[model samples]
Target: MVKTSKTVGRCEEFTANDVEVLGKAPLYQGFFSMVKYRFRHRLFAGGWSEPVDREMFERGHAAAMLPYDPVRDCVVMIEQFRVGAYAAGCAPWQLEIVAGIIEPEEVSEEVVRREAVEEAGLEVGELHKITRYLSSSGGCSETLDVFVGIADSRKADGIHGLPEEGEDIRVRGLSREQAYQWVESGKIENAASIIALQWLQLNYRKLQEAAQDLPLP
Candidate 1:
């Protein structure tokens, strides 16, 4: 295989197409449909290679919120069960940043705010876009857009979720120090939550100082 990060591939005569399965093999009969998706192409100045077969999947995007209360020096996160992790031999339940899938025709920030309200029951104030990146590039094509949302963490309580969606999310708040300890102890296992907490830990002091400058609330 040729290795290059550039758009141009070394094999000039190469042409590829989406794989289509015409039949299923017996080995994977009961479990999965053994369908081969063939990508037919030729190498530059070389004979045609056998078509490459691979499974295809869709790409998805998610918006996550890190609810931060500068005055209280705390952050909010949610705990929920994840089917993907269970299937991957990991703990089925996980503590994660408030996140939701970006619906069709929906804006990223809107998704973040909606998720925060639904999962944590907090009205978002200032929203700071953190960063966007692929969650798992090797197998999954899922991109995550993360944000830091300012909110009142002290009053955060109650079980918040859309009953119609069968969501049983537990909303919880943690002090900056406690959150950092969780990160160090490997307790905040979720990637998005950990990243967001770390970011806040690095900037929490500055945020607290700024909050002090404001008039008494």
Candidate 2:
């Protein structure tokens, strides 16, 4: 008897044709768009299943950066009123990493840099990619690109954010160790913040060695 490997490992196995979009109608259209979709997808066991109708909330793609100061061993965080938290009976004002939505034709680095200044008043230099994930696939269509940007947290203090945009953000710098404590204590509830801090905890030495070769900004 001969042992053979039968693992299917090609993207061609799954394509847009695999899922049939029967119809889609706009349920709401404002700053964001929501749509009702009637579709059918091929099952992993075999062929297509019955048509399923569901509503999807679309907010497009967004990018978020967690600004860090490897030299200072610190991180810059911001606090702002979050409607989602308020609606969920959590604190409206929650601590989070500096982040913003990527505009049309804008790249990940550009969005995070802009957001860093707007949210934390800190200028981010080099960026290390962390992770990209969907905030919630079941309902919202929000894809987030998370990064850890190198910055000088020594002077990252005071309030920031554009008043016209209804943003009132408070910038606060925390030691790397303290930031991790916040994560362990549930003080840092945002996914982007928690992930970035833990990543820094594990990769701080790598960042430090890389920083030594570059000119300080």
By TM-score, the best candidate is 2
Error of 1 at 59 (Å): 5.0
User: Model 2 shows how many backbone clashes?
Assistant: 0
- What are the clash counts of all predictions, listed in order? 0, 0
lDDT tens string, model 2, 1-217? 2122244444326556567788999999998899999988866776668999999999988888888788888888999999989998887999999888878999988999899988888878899999999888998889899898889888788989999999999998988889899999998888778888888889999998999987545
TM, every model: 0.73, 0.91
Weakest 10 consecutive residues, lDDT, candidate 1? 13-22
lDDT of 2 at 159: 89
Name the lDDT value of residue 83 in candidate 1. Answer: 83
**TM-score: model 1 vs. ground truth:** 0.73
